[model samples]
Target: MERAKPSSIKRATALRYMGASGWQPDDATTALLDRAEEKILAAATPRAAVRRLPRAVFPPPELDCGTDLTRHLQGCDAVLLMAATLGSQVDSLLRRLELTDIAMAAAADALSSVLLEQICDELEAEWRAKFAAEHLYLTGRYAPGYGDCPLELNDELCLAVDTVRGCGLAITPQHLLAPRKSTTAILGIADHPVTGTLAGCTTCHLRETCSFRKQGTTCFAK
Candidate 1:
């Protein structure tokens, strides 16, 4: 579900979205993204069927991330899909790309790495404001290529949320999402509450069993 923007908090919050590194937005790109965001917000979307994921983790296992993940994901009420299609990022650097539609791929990669989080942050805060509550904390996002979670599950999760029809977000066979500006993710509801920062799969001792951690950089925390 889309949430209202907290105009009073936009400036400060944008920095928060940027975090310690500070996400600086280019004027032209910011304008484009803002417009796209507006259009997306203006469009009517169906209320997604929200379920508290029995387990939540960066790399979903055959049966969901183990106990700690379940413990952490406990209080989330909905999954925020930060529409990600890195096509645009790569598109800008097309000259250096060697793949098909290199431009789109490059664009998508950059977008996925940079903008998706910020967009999701803005969306997350807005959603919180709409409910007049703050229980909607991100339970950390679980992408494909992490654990036993099949890269294929991306399709199932997106479908469960009615992503394409609802928000015009789509994923490709290569595990890339479309719209070059869209993203999809799961947010399970948590009646209880979790504290502190979100943890990456690497932090979990079970990461040895995780597919993503092996690639380096823990998903939860450094």
Candidate 2:
């Protein structure tokens, strides 16, 4: 897949990622966020790869994604595996800021998280338009480690999309994306409209302990 221009990341979304809620930033805080956004945007070189496969052939049997994801894909005939990253330069930038300014690093980290999600959202929008022409509908994108999906599937997802060769995306031994701002997800393509497929607190493993939930909000809240 080709890179598309990213939509601007909203301050509220970035603040949510930083575990802040029901709070308004002062002028100093806003300036810190601005600097973080600037550095992250300068360092970001977003790229992605996608692979479409028949539902029957997905998950590869050996990897068990559990019942929640199975339910999420119930009516779909095909699946799209996608991987995306903001490049290693962004990772390097965060590391340097951590040494010089912890607060700036934290802000940058949250902003990077928001930026990566924005890229994925744009990719989904593009695919939605493309599939619309084919009369196909897509379930919301679901990433590994959500609900009962195993994080180990990240390795398989990276391979399926050839992310390493296609976008220089990599998985660390801990089953985490190496760039620290990368993501891998799957979307189900169905003949009819699909609902309740979006990732939310109800299906999230961290739901109980999630700070966002405690604050009367969710990570996915607009």
Candidate 3:
């Protein structure tokens, strides 16, 4: 009985039962879940910003690997950073006792994460167009924890973005962002034109030991 009460659940298996249960959802049920996902996204807030580096050339910061963001990110108009985490609304579904409701909640989570990534992509594209208007160039967007970028800078990026106000998401004491899958990123802008993904790869610090590089394939660097 206590297990059925819902609070004790570390995880739920709503999707797992759907195939075997032979249950059919009506329009209303589907609509309800869709609405819930919208609500979750609407409730989400994000913090983002661009910061200028100090004029004095500082010592090259140690890389999380051999990657240095400052070196790679230099000569850009600004660095775009965003931070967000799971909100209370997202937590509610996991805490529900009803099996159907729990599934809907899981649906909401899956949809929300996908939507969140979409938002980032959309915003990045829009920003690219905006910068183009002024004949500016950018290196596209890249997050802190990818390739040679240091994963540890996640905290600093969050703070720069005013994360809590912009979004309900926050990081846990251990540096894990609440909701588990939230993300942050940095975009580099160039005064002149930047090259393509293949070229970017070639110039990247990771290139020497990168899988692509290992295969003797190389990007055309500008």
Candidate 4:
């Protein structure tokens, strides 16, 4: 298991998660977000685990992750299965806030989402450099539930990475990641650089009903 240091969340990213992109927050809202960020940072403990496996071992035998993921991994020699979490303390903080201050709780939730992504981003950077040293390249990180990929694949991914024992990451019966701010993903290890990968709302499974799209924005909106 690899531990990551807590980092500051991008305010814009958190605002996007909060559905407040392009809308200037008033002083009160800004202060609320500031406090939320502080609390979330104090409560989060980022950790991750990665398992590199042969391409043949991916998708497991009984499951199909659809063509999008298949195409993403085409020609790759190996797969990097990864799991990460913001830890249970953040979940506990949110639960406590939900009892008294709904707005604060919501803000903290959004910030926590952004914080988790930041942790993943840092990990990706590390992986990139580490692989580059071996003269290899990586495809973008593709998580289950991203496009045609079945969300249930998360179960297999968690198992592959030993997420529960490694980082206390688990999937609930509802198939959602426990701790609320954890993720599982895979990346292709290609001898050559991978290109033309589709990302953002275009490939997202929730595109049809995405609140960001309905609001004339995107989750990736800056």
| Model 4 error, position 203 (Å) | 6.8
The residue pairs that clash in candidate 3, if any, are 45-166, 45-167, 46-166, 46-167, 85-169, 137-190
**Cα lDDT computed for each candidate against the true fold:** 0.44, 0.85, 0.51, 0.86
Candidate 4 backbone collisions, by pair: none
Instruction: Give the candidates in order of lDDT, highest first.
Output: 4, 2, 3, 1
Q: Write the per-residue lDDT of candidate 3 for residues 108-152, one digit (tens) a residue.
A: 665556545555555667678887897877675566545555556
lDDT of the structure predicted as candidate 4: 0.86
Write down the TM-score of every candidate: 0.47, 0.92, 0.55, 0.92
Question: Model 2, which residues run further than 4 Å from truth?
Answer: 1-7, 196-204, 207-209
Please write out the lDDT profile of model 4 over residues 1-222, one tens digit for every residue. 656666567897778777777678899999999999999999998899999999888988568787788888888989988899989999999999999999999999999988888889889889989999999988878888887888899988998888999999999886789988898889999898884254667667899899988998766555
Off by over 4 Å in 3: 1-65, 68-78, 84-86, 94-102, 165-168, 179-181, 195-222
Residue 78 miss distance in model 2 (angstroms):
0.4
List candidate 1 segments past 4 Å from native.
1-71, 75-112, 134-138, 179-182, 195-222
lDDT string for model 2 (137-194, tens) is 9988888999878898888889888888988999889899978889998899998998
TM-score of 4: 0.92
* Residue 159, candidate 2: C-alpha displacement in angstroms: 0.9
Which candidate comes out best when scored by lDDT?
4
Sequence-dependent TM-score of model 1: 0.47
